[model samples]
Target: MIKLANYTQGQWQEGTGPGTTLYDPVLGTALASVDAGGLDMAACYDWARTQGGTALRALSYAERAALLKQIGQVLQDNRDKYYDISLQNSGTVQNDTAVDVDGAIYTLSYYAKLGGKLPAHVHLEGESQGLARDNAFASQHIEVPARGVALLINAFNFPSWGLWEKAAPALLSGVPIVVKPASATAWLTHEMVKDVIEANILPAGALSIVCGRPEGLLDALNALDMVSFTGSADTAASLRGHRRIQHDGVRFNAETDSVNSALLGPDDSDAAADLLVREVVRELTIKSGQKCTAIRRIFVPESRYEAIAGAIAAKLKTITVGDPRKPEVRMGSLVSRQQHEAILAGIAQLSHHCEILFNGSTEITIQAEAGSACVAPMLFGAKDPDTNPLVHQVEVFGPVATLMPYRDTEHAFELVRRGMGSLVASVYSEDPQFMAQAAIRLAESHGRVHLVNTEVAKVQTGHGNAMPQSNHGGPGRAGGGEELGGLRALKFYHRTAAIQASPDILNRLIQNAE
Candidate 1:
C-alpha cells in the first residue's frame, strides 16, 4: 500500500506500525494508508517558530510573496497528478476536481501578485500621533506577523483548495503553518505538499502536512499560536472547549456547516426560471453538492412555484451518476462509504418534511463495483418552511436541495433567514427593486448576498463559487469567522501594536531600508 508521511522539521517523517487504509470511492478498492503515530508535536512546532519563522521574518512582504508564486508554479506543473488522485480518492470528475486544484493555484497566484505592492515587515494602521508638545516623541499604530506558528485543520471536501486558501494568507503575512488534512481525502493534499517540499521552494518547517489522526495537535499550540479549521459545527464546538483555546487564548477561526440558500425574485419570467434552474443544477452536481456553500434551501415566489420547481426537477434528471473515470459521467460518488451512509440517513429524515420533486434512480449509468458510493442528485419541496424545521436546521451535505414557496418578498426573506446563518444567499430576478431588497434583507443572515439578474446571469460566478477577493465565512451556525477577503485575511495571522517613539524613529519603521 502507498504510505503517506508527514513533512516537518525539514524532512519526510513516516509514522510507525499499521495505519488506516484509504479506499477508492468508485471501486471500493484499497488505495493507500496514512499514519500520525510516534511523532514529536512539540519539536515540530519549535522548528516552525524558530527556524522557519526566523527565515520568513527576515524577508520583506514582497520577497515572501515571490515564494508563493514559486509554490503556485510547482502545483501548476503537477496539476494532472492531483487530478488523477482526486478521481481515485475523491471520486470526482475532471470538472469537479478543477475547482479544488485550479482554485488553489489561483489563490496562491493572487496573493503573490498582490503582495508585490505591500511594505516589508510592518503595516501602519493609521497616521502618526503626537505624544509630546515638544515634538520629541510620537506614536504609530502598526501591524506585524505574530511570533507563534499557525495550525490549519482542513475538511474532507476540496482538500487542495482548503489547504491553499488558509496557507496563502498565513505565509504571505510571514507566519509558518502546519496543515492537518482530513484523513479520508488527504492524498491530493499530501501530493501537493510533497511537490512543494521536494522543489525546496519554501524554507525548512515553513509548511508541514500531518496526515491521519490529530491527537494532541491542539495541546502543542501556545497562546501566540493560531488555528484555522474547516469542518462540522460539533467539532468546532469541541475544539473551542480545548483548554488551550479556552484558557490560553489560542486564536481560533472556523468555517463550519452552512445551509446556504438561493431565492428566485418576484419576477416570474421564463428566462429567470431557466437561469435559476441552470445554476441550482450546477450547484447540486458540482462537487456532488458536498460544498459548505452549496444551496440547500431554495425559495421561489408562490405564483411561480409550480413552474420553477418543475424546471429544476427536470434539469436534475439529466445528471449522469457513475464512476468519474467514465467520460460520459457528469457526477460521481461521495468521498467515502461512511459519508455515503450518513447522507442516505440524512435523506431519509429530510423526506419526512418535504415531498419528493425528483427521486433519481439508484442504477449507475456506467458499470462499476456494487459497493461504489455513487448517488444522483435529488430535489424536494416544502410547502410550509416554518413548520418543517429540519429543512433549515439539518444540512444533508450531499446532492440534495429543498424548494419552498413564498407568499411575497418578505416571506421569502423570513424563510431564508430561518436557516440562522449561511455562507451565501443568491437572488435571481430581473426585478431591480426585489433584488435590491433581497440583498439588503439577506445580508442580515448571510456573509454574502449575491444578486443575479439577467444581465449578470451570464457572468456572475455561480452561487457555490467562493472567490478569493470576497470573504468566505459567515456568522452564528456558520462559525462567525472570516477568511479570503483579498489581503484582509493577513490580519488574522498578524498582531497590531502601537509603537511609541520619536518622530524620526516612527518614520523609519514604515518600510524596508528606510
Candidate 2:
C-alpha cells in the first residue's frame, strides 16, 4: 500500500494520528490508508504566509508559469501511476483519470499561454487623455497578485484538476498556495504534489497541503489571505461568513453544484437526435454522473418528449456498470457507501417531486461484488418544463437526469432559468438566431453556457462539464460565486488599488510593487 504524505515548507512529513483507508470504487476494497491528524495548522499557515508567499511573489508571472509547465509535464510523464492511484478513489476510469491528472498539467500549459496574451501590469487599458498639444497619455492597466495566501479548498470529484485549475493561476499571479483537497480523495492530489516536489519544479514554501479538517484555520487568517472553495453552497456560505474573513475583507470565491441543464435542437433530424441521446447517456454514466457540471435537467419540446425519452432510455440501458478497470464497464461505482447513500437520498427527493421515467433499471441488473455499492444511469421525465416543480429544485448528483418538455424557444429559456442559477447550461441548435437567443438569456442565470449543434456537437463539450478556461459557479443556488476563469482567478488572490501618478512615479511604483 502506498502511503500519502503532506508537502509542507518543501519537506515531506508523516502524521502522528492513525490513517484513514482509501478504497477502490469497484468492490469497496481498501487500497491505501492516509494519515490526516496531528499536524500544526498554525505553523502551516505561517509557513505559507512568510516563506511561501514571499518566495512566490518574488518570481515574475512568466517565471512562475514556467515552473507550472514543468510540473504539468512531469505529471504527464507519470500519468500511469496517477491512474493507478486514482482508481482507488472510485468513478475513475482511464479517460476520467486523464482528464483529472493530464487535464491539470494542460491547465498549466494554458496558463503559460494566457501569460503571453495578457498584460504584465496590474491594470487594464483605460481611456486616453490629452496631456498637451501633440502629446497624449494612454492609460493601460494590469493586475497584480495579492500579497497574501490563496487557500484552495477543493472538491472530492476531479481532485487534481480542481486544485490545479486554481493553483496554476494563483501561482502564476505570484501568490503562494495552501491547498486543502477534499478529505475523500486527497491522496491523488498528494501524489501529484509529491511529483512536483521531487521534480524540484517550485520554490520551497510556494505550496503546502493540509490532509484533514481545517478547524480554526480560517479564524486565524489575515486580510491578505484569500480563499477559493469548491463544494456545497451551504458550506461556502459558512466559510464566507467567518468572523475574520467577513470583518477583515478576506477574498472569497466559491464553485458550488447546482441544477445544470441542456436543451435539444428543435430542427435536429432523427440521426441528430440519436447523437444527442448518446451524449446524454455518456454524461449520465461517466464518473457515475458525480460531476458538478453534469446535466441534471434536460429540456425538450413537448411534442417530442416521447421520442427523446425513448432514445435516451435505450442508450442508458446499454451502459455497463462495475469496476472502472474492466474493459467492458462503461461506468464505475460511486466514491463510497456514504456517497452512494447521499445519491440515493437525492434520488428519493426527486421521486417525491417528479415522476420517474427511467429508474436506472439496468444498474441493478449487474451483480455487485461483496461490499460494493452501485447504481446504473437513471432518467426521469417531467412533462412540462415550465410547470414541473421538481425539475429545477432537485439534483440527484448521480447518473440521473430529469427530462422536461418546453412549448417553444421562449418556454425553453424559461425552463432553463428555472434552475435559478447554474454552473453551466447547454443548448443544442443549428440556427444562429435560436442559439443566440437561448444563450444570451441563459447566460444571465448561468455562469457558463455551451451552444451545441450538429457542427459543434461532435467536438462539443457535453452539457454538464466546466473546463479550466471557463468560469465555474453561478448566482443563487449554484453557490452565487465563481472560480478558475483564466487570469480572473488570479484576482481572487490579490488586492487592487487605484493609483494616480506621473509616468516616472508610476514606473517607480511598478518597479517596487512586488
Candidate 3:
C-alpha cells in the first residue's frame, strides 16, 4: 500500500516511523499508511514565511488572483479523480463529493475574481478622520499583510472545501499556509495537495501539508502565526488555551461543534408544513448529518407536532444507505469505523432523554462489504425538551435529530435558545408577520437564519449550506469567530494600523488617498 507523505520545504518526504493504516470506509480495507515522523516543523514554517510568503507578497492582488484562478481551473479539469478518492475514503456519493471538490474550486475562483477588483496594496479602512481643530491633522486606518504563515487544522468531514476555503482568503492577503488535515480522512487532502504542487499551481512554499500526528507543530508557532481550526468543542477549547496562544499571542480562530436548531412557526398552513418537513429531512441525511451546521434541535407548534414528525419520518425512510459507488445509495457510510462507533455512542446518550421516533437499525442491508462503516438514520422525539437537558446538550454528529413541540411562538424561541449558540437555524412560516417576529429573536443565538417560505423555498439553499459570500462562524458555544463574509475573511490574515499625521504626511502614507 502507498504511504501518505508530508509536503514541506519544497519537497515531499515520507514519514520515518511505521504509520497507522488508513481504511476505505466502504470496504473496511487498508488503503494507505499515514505518518509525519521526523519532519522539521520549524524548517517548514521558515520556508513558508521566506520563500512562499515572499513570492506571494511580491504580487499585486490582481496578479495573485490570477494564480488562484489558474489553480481552480486545473483542479476542475482533474475533478473526477478527486471524486473517486472522496468516494473510497469519505464514503460520499457523487452529489456529496461535489459539495467538497466543486465547492473548493468555486470558492477559489470566486476569490480570484474578487481580488481583481481590489487595489494592489494595503486596504484602506474608512475615510480619514480630522483630528485637529484646524483640520490640518488627520488619522486613517490601513490593513497590511501580517507577514506570517497560517496554520490550518481541518476536520474530517470536508477535506477539500475546508482547505481551499481558508487558503483562498489567506493567499489573497499574501500569507502562506500549512495544513494539517484530520488523520482519518487525510488521504483525499493529501492527494489534492499533491496535484496542486505537481501542477505548480502555488509558489514553492505558499502551501504545504503534514499528515498523521501533529506533534511538535504547535510548539513551532510564534506570535506572528495564525491558526484556524474546525473540529470538536473539547479540542477547540484545548487549542485556545495552549501556552502559545495564551502567552505568545498567536492568533487563533475556531469553528467548533454546535447544536444548531430549526424552528417551525405557529402558522398551520400546508405550504409551511411541507417546507419544514423537507428542510429537516435534508439536514438530517445530507452527508449523513456530519455537518457542523446540521439541525440538531427541531421545534414545532404543539398542535402540528404529530404531522411534522410523521412527515419527516416517512420521508427519511425512503433514503438508501450503502456504498457510494452504487447508484441507488442516497446516503453512504460515515468517515470510518471509529466515527461510526462515536455516532452510536452519541445516539445512546440522546436516547436517555428522548424517545426514538425512527430508529434505523445497525444491521443494514448494504451494497458494500458486511463490515462497512454504515449506520442507519435515527430520529428522537423529546416530549419535554425543557426538562430533558441531555436533548439540548448532547449532539449526535450523524443522521440523528431531536424533535420537540412548543406551546407557542414564544416557547419555540425559548426552546431554540436552549442550544446556547449555533452556526445556523431555519424558521418556516407562511405568515410574514410571524416570521419577522420570530426571526428577530432567533438572530440573537444563530449566526445565520434561513427564512423559508413558498416564494423563496424553490430557490433556497437549504439549512446546512454555508455559502462562500456569507459569514460562517457564530458566537458563544459556536466559537465566536467570523469567516468568509466577503472581504472580512481576508482581515484575519492582515493587521490594521492607524496612521496619524499632517495632511501631506497622511497623503504620502495612504496610497490612493481621496
Tell me, by lDDT, which candidate is best: 1
Question: Cα-based RMSD of the predictions, in order?
Answer: 1.7, 2.8, 1.4
Which candidate number would show the highest TM-score if scored against the true structure? 3
**Residue-by-residue lDDT tens digits, candidate 2, 104-207:** 87788888777655444453434334454543332324456777778889888888888888888888877888888887787788888877878877777888
TM-score of 3: 0.98
Residues 1-514, candidate 3: write the lDDT tens digits: 7899899999999989878888898898888788998989999999999999999998888888998998898889889999988898889998889888998998998999999988887789988899998869899889988888999999999999999999899999999999999988888899988888999978889999999885678899878999999999899999988888988999999888899988887878898889888888888877888999999988988888788788888988888888887899999989999999999899888877778888777433556778888888888998888788888788889999989999987788888888888898898888999988877888888788889999898898879888888889887788887778779899999999898989888787765522
Which stretches in model 3 have alpha-carbon errors above 4 Å?
Answer: 362-367, 512-514
User: lDDT (CA) for every model shown?
Assistant: 0.89, 0.75, 0.88
Q: Report the lDDT tens digits of candidate 1 across residue range 374-404.
A: 7778888998887888898989999999999
TM-score each candidate.
0.97, 0.92, 0.98
Error of 3 at 406 (Å): 0.7
Task: Please tell me which model should have the higher TM-score, number 1 or number 3.
Answer: 3
**Deviation from native of the Cα of residue 166 in model 2, angstroms:** 0.9
